[model samples]
Target: MTGTFKKIRRRVWLILNILVVFWMLAGVLCMQVPPSEFWPAGFVALSLPGALVLNFLFLLYWVFRRSWLLVLPLAALLLGWNYYGRLLAINFAEEVPKEAKTLQVLSFNTHVFNAYDKIVEGVPQVSNDMVDWVATHPADVFCLQEFYSRVNSIEYNNFNRIGTRYGKYKFVSTLETDRIKANLGIVIFSKYPILQGGTIHFLNKQRESANRAAWADLDVNGDTVRIYAVHLQSMSIKSEDIENTYSAIGNEESFKKEGRNVARRLKRGFIARAQQVEQLLEHVRQSPYPAIVCGDFNDIPFSYTYQELAEELENAFVKAGNGVGATYNGPLPFLRIDNQFYSPGLRAVSFETHYEMGLSDHFPISATYVLEPKAAE
Candidate 1:
């Protein structure tokens, strides 16, 4: 019995060594795929451990052996992923100019003027608070997602006064249903003449709510600059989902089992966000004019969504704002959900977070951008 136990222990060690080496090689092969293919690539990359665990259970089989020769390939893959991330970071900073009439733009989720509790209830105000915020802004152009307005339907004419003030403004709704006030919508107001504008809603998998984009062609100083407003999916994890997980249970055995599952779900959400970002990337790639993308992305700086969307655009706050630019008005003040991105011809002179404003859960974010007309073309 002692001799048999010793042999089993030796076999386990050998299996672990082979598995580790195989994982290293798999990581290398994974690096060959681009971030654009991150969905399929990421799914496989993320599921490897589970697959390997099963393989480890069958360790007595000779088929479980790993190819040690793939070590070099695995190393190459690790370096490739690292390099890809670095390249993306570099691209994000490439469009920001050292110096250029700064165009000021503001983007706020506005929580539909109903705040967090209001959003939770799925009911929001028509246009009173949003009109107030819009009226007070000093921005050359303003973009807002989750904009709600049912008051100015010719009968009420509540938002007429506010709407008439702007030279050119657009209010686009992804969902036309009158049932929910702030379902899927976006609004853009500009002091400059708006030549044209349109809305693009994402491929709705659930067909429940709209994840959308709105854009406007603004004629500024005889040049056309396109502005895009985006609001991706919510990253909120359900409380019930958390409770069902073993990690949340706080037991040693269950903790290890459920902790990884919770993390995996979070990672899946991040990957989904990245996929949504890929849509914006396609739009940006096709853009003919210098562009500005501003809105609440439901993401943070270090996230894949932020990093990918920012690949060729300059983040306004990083250039001009001081401190941790948090925008989501929650218990945590470090959430910078609101953001503004512009092309390389634009210079971010200043960026501010209106923390003093208590009207909405999200603090309105504003930035003054200078566009080099000569370089814009």
Candidate 2:
């Protein structure tokens, strides 16, 4: 009877260890493969946090059991240290005096400032709050995604108001949807003079009106720094999709359909973003000046879109931020989709994710950088 119990326990332990091995391999592959090579890997990448947590539990279990199995997860963790660092960091906070040479930049996805809100009584209250926030917390550069404004509409003139409020700064935007009555796109307001600016449109047939990258060449204190404010391919997960996902407990058929829909959307987004990243990287490489890229990437830290960009630029969050800097504020709170990456020539002094204001589905991210003298020259 005791032997039978011991045999059962051993079998369960073996199964658990096998599951850990599978997840660990998947997590490692996520860091190595680009979604361009195999799009399915991107989905695996998204499950990395879950894999990490499970491995941690396994590590604890093996420690208590005084078994040599602890080495499996411990080695996997050590091997994936670079990928883990991008998701979370431990930095001791210290007072770093603001220097005259530092450039402060903020990136935010305003979600049209809740202009289409129905659940909320006041439609534009969030919009008004965001405007007020921008007016007060001024930065050298503001890269905004999903920015919207309606012509002659008092409540929707946020685009004009923001530009007028920051009158001294140069404002550049890509008007993807330029209708007679309204406009929607990405915008960049820079304290420095904008010498040149343009947009890089994705060639996908199913592209959204706001899916594109806008860039500006700013003359910052006699230095020409090119900055790209980009909005990548969205997952297109509608409210109904969220509802279906949550309420799929009882109906098996409905659950399967909803799962397929969500997976299809994600797969499409991954492929489109892969193509977009290649084009954007080409554009960045052609730039004559040092570059700083900021906006809602719509991809997590372990994604191919991030890996490609990180290969060319330095992530501001990984450099100066502390903790899991999750920028996406939604049902899934652990997603840090919005990001800021700068050329190696700039040093990130500070990085912050603002979550206090619930104006949009994304938390605003800001980073201060000091340009190296040689790069500035």
Residue-pair clashes, model 2:
0
Write the residue-wise lDDT of candidate 1 on 1-377 in tens digits. 99999678757765665665576446435534433446454444443434333333433333334535334334433444432232122213234455435678888876655533443355443445555666667788878777655542542232343456454465555455455332336778777888988776555343533667788888886878899988876665444455666235657777677766656665555555666777777887788888988887876554556656666787777766766677887654466767888886677777788887766767888887777767334
Per-prediction backbone clash count:
5, 0
What tens digits encode model 2's per-residue C-alpha lDDT throughout 1-377?
99999778967886787697688677667756767678888888777777777877777888888878788878877886777788697765545555546788989988877766633443333367876686567688888888877756676576567776667454556463433345677888877888889998876754544488999988988878888999998978876787888899688998999999999999888888888888889999998888889999998887788888988899999989999999987877678999999886787878999988667888999998887678334
Best by TM-score: 2
TM per prediction = 0.64, 0.89
Worst window of 10 by summed lDDT in candidate 2: 118-127
Candidate 2, overall lDDT?
A: 0.80
Query: RMSD to native for every prediction?
Result: 9.6, 3.1
Candidate 1 Cα RMSD after full superposition onto the native fold (Å): 9.6
Local distance difference test, per candidate?
A: 0.63, 0.80
Best model per lDDT:
2
